[model samples]
Target: MDVLTTQTLSGVQTSIEIAGTVAFALSGVMEAARKKLDAVGVCAVASVAAFGGGTLRDVLLDRRPLFWIEQSWYLWSVLGLCIAAMVLMRAKHFKPTEKSMQWPDALGLGLFAASGTQIALGLQMPALIAVLMGVITATFGGVLRDIVCNEIPTAFHDHHPYAVCAFAGGWVVVVLHYLGFYPNAVVAIGAATVTLLRLAALQFEWRLPTWKIED
Candidate 1:
């Protein structure tokens, strides 16, 4: 891709990044509240869930200033979002369940996967590596969030095709880009594909067969 194309893709990636941040932050807030954590714990978990994956990806790619460091407003935004979510969840009649996180988590997974894939592609990374980065960007945040909350990481133990959703969607982005789709269109299609696939997995309880150790 030319400089113009790369810049265009970067713009799309920024939007996807922001969207994924909000989505993942919401999931973190819900989980924190469900665990009866205080505001401080909520903010901590939410920030990690919002930025962990991207932060790791940036480190791997040796991207300078880090994403949140470059965009300090992102931190403030996530803080405000967590506060608002806490207020909403504190409602007596409003109970946030683990199930409630599925939709937003799926959305985050898709967007981050697309953005990560596009970022790697722009850097001229190999397709498989790009896809791996995408999956990491999409699911690693939730992994950290669960661990911080003293819970089993749902992405690991749920057997619900969480990272698989991101992997499949990453390929969609790669295919679309190679097929000459517009930059925005590629991200949109990839994100949507991942989100829809994740939702379907939840709806159908899709699972990867686990190795059974003989008792």
Candidate 2:
């Protein structure tokens, strides 16, 4: 686990991010179930919300065979998570207790973002593009979720430094990698740092400014 947590953003650390993606995907399933969405609907929402950004990034970069496509397990794992979530929901009436989910979801965001950034670098992408990939990986799913729920995306109003933290941490890993640090460890630190900071922000109800314009 320490080694897993300490790697820089390489395919070597992709397993960690993949696990995080599964967790995030499961959360989406739980959310859909909470809304009493049907089986297909739940899976549909989870699939798009979980893997949307990564899929798009792969396509844009002309990453042949695609990220999930190459690793059949990636798609299978997401399906497995969705199935498990559905089964769990059916077994016990699904409800968000407010305590169980908040932190894991936040942590997952950090992990996925760092993972995405690393993957981009591994593909030899430019730093700006890699950072954008990280942001998308970390944040776009939540945006899709919000739209499905008919709410504003969380980051638009600066509810917290959600994407900012991910962006910074992903870049931290990338920079450290370029500076000769072991990719695996640096990535682990960056991802974990983002997770901790984000969780802390949520824990303390910390948020950025909400500007109001009045005529």
Best by lDDT: 1
Query: What lDDT score is found at residue 210 in candidate 2?
Result: 71
Q: How accurate locally, in lDDT, is each candidate?
A: 0.84, 0.73
lDDT of 2: 0.73
TM-score of 1: 0.86
Which pairs clash in the backbone of model 2? 6-184, 6-185, 7-184, 7-185, 8-183, 8-184, 8-185, 8-187
- How many residue pairs in model 1 have overlapping backbones? 0
In candidate 1, position 27 carries an lDDT of: 80
- Residues 92-171 of candidate 2 have per-residue lDDT tens digits of 86655657766666667778777778778877888988888888878887678667856677667656788888888888
Cα error, residue 35 of model 2, in Å, equals 3.7
Top-TM-score structure, candidate number:
1
Model 2 residue runs over 4 Å out of place are 1-15, 94-96, 148-150
Each prediction's RMSD to truth: 2.8, 4.1
